[model samples]
Target: MTELNILHHSSYPPESNGHGGSKRTAQVLELLVTNGYDYTSVDFDTIKALKTLKWQKKVSLFLGTLLRFPFKGKNISFKRLKRVDRLKFISKAFIAELSSIPDIYIWESTLDIHQFIAAELKAKGSKIIGIAHNLESLVPCASQFGAIVHHKSPINRFAQELETLSICDEIFVISREEQWLLNLFNIGAKYLPYYPIIETRNNLLEIRKRRALRQKNNEFLILGTVLNPPTLNGTIELIKMVSEVSPANAIIHIVGYGTERLKPHLTGYSQFQLHGGVDRSALEDILAKIDAVVLNQPYTTGSLTRIPEMLIAGIPVICNEAAARSFYNYSGVYLFSNEHELTDFLSNPMDTPLIPKEERVYTDLFIKTLKLAV
Candidate 1:
């Protein structure tokens, strides 16, 4: 592809602060460049929990959490602004980043409320595409935006949501699961595997293997995010169970940079390692070495890129019951719900598991969509 000005839109600061979507957004940015697309990303940070009215302070605080939000925080929007005020805040962001407009505008939306900007960009003769991570209705109750979107009355803003959804040129679905989800809204979409995919390589496999062997302690490793309201605290729960067995060689590696809520088990465990606020390469290298990647949360429609990363790295994944339902071919993947199931896998590790390297499948389709939109 020729030099394309791709405007990557996000709901969080694309910096070192701990946010999963933002981290995934950054990874995709590198992948876009590697794929020969000259791109510039525009992040419209959500303003739900964020209170700093100052622009410089808002950006600075967000960058601090960059190290561990994806896996650690249950709700990433805690640091952002409230919903009713979000668009107004984003209006400031639009004005801030307005000086630079690109050839294509790709928005990775967590909510339809942000869809208005994409539709507007498309109206301005730019290609617009969005990867919806969560259904807006579900988000209202499950998200910090829930009350804001439907504060006292869901009846009021229902019309605005529809108006926003109608304007986008094309909305991309992350998987067949998400495609089916879009049906509920009657939105047309293209299902590209890992809609915003991060690059995976075999070399990562070697790095993982070597890292595993380097550890004199032979215990299975555990690491991932633990969110607030304890919705996605599976990783913390798993550690509690694993520590019960008292394995001598095992270690728990946490990249948790989310809310500073403390778990009791973290206090006394000698094997538990908290590597927070590290750069991407350092984090990636560490992930390359772990015995098995952990996805402790229940299933959602959004595609999990780490699944591909773990698969391509030949690392087995210990996913819970919820994640197992959405993923396929468990020959190399391990599923667990309790302590007994996890302890059993720690003793017998799998060698070289399968991870789908489905880059080309989407590249062809994504380019076609861009062509049509442009």
Candidate 2:
């Protein structure tokens, strides 16, 4: 029996909204648990306790590097703890508890701190599988040279990410675009399709019922996080385009985190409604009233998990060509390029029939992705 050790940054409480990396981490664990993997999950946030605290039972404390420690620890600040000291503590505690490495180790994000630890684990006959959630190499100064392939010297966080991944037996990404970009750098990786959390209570029957109620209004909506530069700038640009072409009667609903940033931009537009972070039930209620959902992420690097969720709602989705990288071939996705194209479609939209809920099988994709990873 092959044992699996899953490593991640933090814990996702059931009620947590789970934005960004947290969401991906939760999804990965859920899939592994659901598929009957004899797995152990080690969260790094609480890993430091393993050092000073004495324990009878073997507790796992695994840390992924990319997780940002914003605040000071109880006794010592994260920055104050030297890297060498931290590494030693983790190494000693892990060896004392586990005695031997597991058959397989699936690391959530590759960080330089993990390289030495992972190398040692590999030596103990463990297969290191890295989930490259985002391409660090493309993150400008933060990562590597980004899209600059012919740079004289490549360095920074991206170098560490590449070095760590190179040591891994296999690598997986959530976006086709990322897979292509990684391949360009001569790195071998597989594209794993993203799977949204589908609940029986909020099933396809309910989604279609919501969509039916929504379609009668013929309203447009663009929703997600606007805190980041890519999403914030993209949402602003999309709004500007819509303002130029959309009819005076058109009602556009903007929801999710950082929507307050859009208030200044929509001064003249009475049709635009901004709903900042709301409860899950309230969000669903808003989605139920939205006719068509627009995804305008021109600078999105990794997979947009929200797209799959929107599709599952049985609503017509209008997004840019670049934003549709993940689902370009999916029959239900509607693609457009510029403001002219989007405005034209909005003016006299064609009949985009609701896709059967059964066809949107996220679990099937998850199963297929897991098989390819191992």
Among all candidates shown, the one with the greatest TM-score? 2
TM-score of 1: 0.68
Clashes of 1: 26
Locate the minimum summed-lDDT window of 10 residues in model 1.
146-155
Q: Backbone clash tally for model 2?
A: 1
TM-score of 2: 0.76
Candidate 1 structure quality by residue, lDDT tens digits, 232-251: 45555666766676357676
In candidate 1, position 364 carries an lDDT of: 74
lDDT for each of the candidates?
0.57, 0.63
Instruction: Give the per-residue lDDT of model 2 (tens digit) for 325-344.
Output: 77876645778887788886
Residue pairs clashing in model 2 are 143-158
Model 1: residue 56 alpha-carbon error in angstroms: 23
